[model samples]
Target: MKRLVFILLLVFAGICCSCKNDDDGGCVGVDCLPPETQTGENTFGCLLDGEPFIPRGGVNPLDCVYQLIDGERYFNLEAAMNDAGFNEIAISITTNAKEIIENQTYSLVSEFEVGGVSGKYIFNGDIFDTDNQNSGKLTITHLDIDNQIVSGTFFFDVIDQNGELREIRDGRFDMKFTR
Candidate 1:
């Protein structure tokens, strides 16, 4: 029955090959945004003006900093991406608040000295930031100080020099921090 065995093997191979999953990096439907994960996956993504703004390249596509400034704890997280032409686009959240705990929502203000959070967006040499008039919120979903991992979600609106408001939404990041 050698002939019969050969035919069965061919069928099995074809079935196995067909069962291979074609996953496009955890994409879901039309919006190919990365899934929101609390684990330290080092992922950063958001929707900028309704388009996907996922950090793609650079020495550090995703980075976080936790330090003490003048006896006050400071925190900063930055995500950057280089486009096809090498233009850098970045988004950052910073705060010098005394404590950064989980499940806390912070307001994104313009001034860091005012004792609140701040958000910034840089694109094509233009810098936009949150101000009293244009602001947003950042919610810390997970924070592990000993392990140096942090995960959060944020959204903000910033005004450019031309007074054009840019919207950044559906943002999420999970990464390890450095001191």
Candidate 2:
């Protein structure tokens, strides 16, 4: 009976080891692909401090909000890395309808003034935003106004309130804007 019990324990161990409990930094869902891979609908990804930074929505949920204000189109994309407020990131891009066309490139400005395409990275205590000191570019690879599908790539450098600079690279977003 002891030998039989030992055998059962081994079987249970094997089963437990074979099960997959997939997750992405506490975010659950098949859409939560391993951070190394970056491709999804309504997805945004980049590298932060040489680590994969993929944004996800939780109970509060991330949003890709779009609006046409004063003849300019604004696209605001946000991702919550965690349930905590300090772990979120926001990217806002403003351009005219003509500038947002497919296969076009738009300049990313660090100015806090109007019509600036900027990025913000917020961590436990570190926060950074595009300022007039840095430069970046955004390329629109696809835009479907009828279906409201917008896809783009971007990279930028932002400065923290304390004057520290952080670079965000390999950024990509494929989102259907919510009007």
Candidate 3:
């Protein structure tokens, strides 16, 4: 079976990696990655697409699972919208991450799911170490923000629905705001 073969391959790969014969060999094992380069933005071409994106500085997937912090403003930029009005109105976003509007502030977390690919990401969310895609047909049910009505344009990197992936990058939506 494919599963059995995959498991055997992994076992062999692990053994070969531990062996001290990698300096020059036929099977180099799972490319020995640097300590800090084990997992990177989706651009790195990762098979397992889980959250906590960077494992550190970046917004851990856990944060996305929490409730949007209270007191944080959630303005409906659209005066009113319906199924026929999605994305037609404007939405301005401003976070307290910065002192004023002129400063680069907080980053919004957007969930993406389609064609067997899913993951939580930012505007230019890279799919690891690859030039997957940052633009795709958007389907938004709400637009909460603060300040002007949708200021700058928001960007998104869409995964290649038909591209290769080792993991299904699905995610749970639970965004909370904090000060």
Compare the candidates by lDDT and give the number of the best one: 1
What overall lDDT goes with each candidate model?
Answer: 0.82, 0.63, 0.26
Residue-level lDDT of model 3, residues 15-46, one tens digit each, is: 99897853324332223211221111111111
Q: Best-fitting candidate, measured by TM-score?
A: 1
**TM-score of model 2 relative to the true fold?**
0.66
- Full candidate order by lDDT, most accurate first: 1, 2, 3
Candidate 2, lDDT over the whole model: 0.63
Please tell me which model should have the higher TM-score, number 2 or number 3: 2
TM-score of 1: 0.78
lDDT of 1 by residue, 59-172 (tens): 877778978767778888888888668888889988865467899998888645746688899887577779898899999999998888889999999987677888889988
Predicted candidate 2 versus true structure: per-residue lDDT over 1-179, tens digit per residue:
99999999999999999977655545533233333222327777766545556665545345676677667666766655663445545444443333366887766664355555666666544646665677577787877777777787877777766667777777777877776
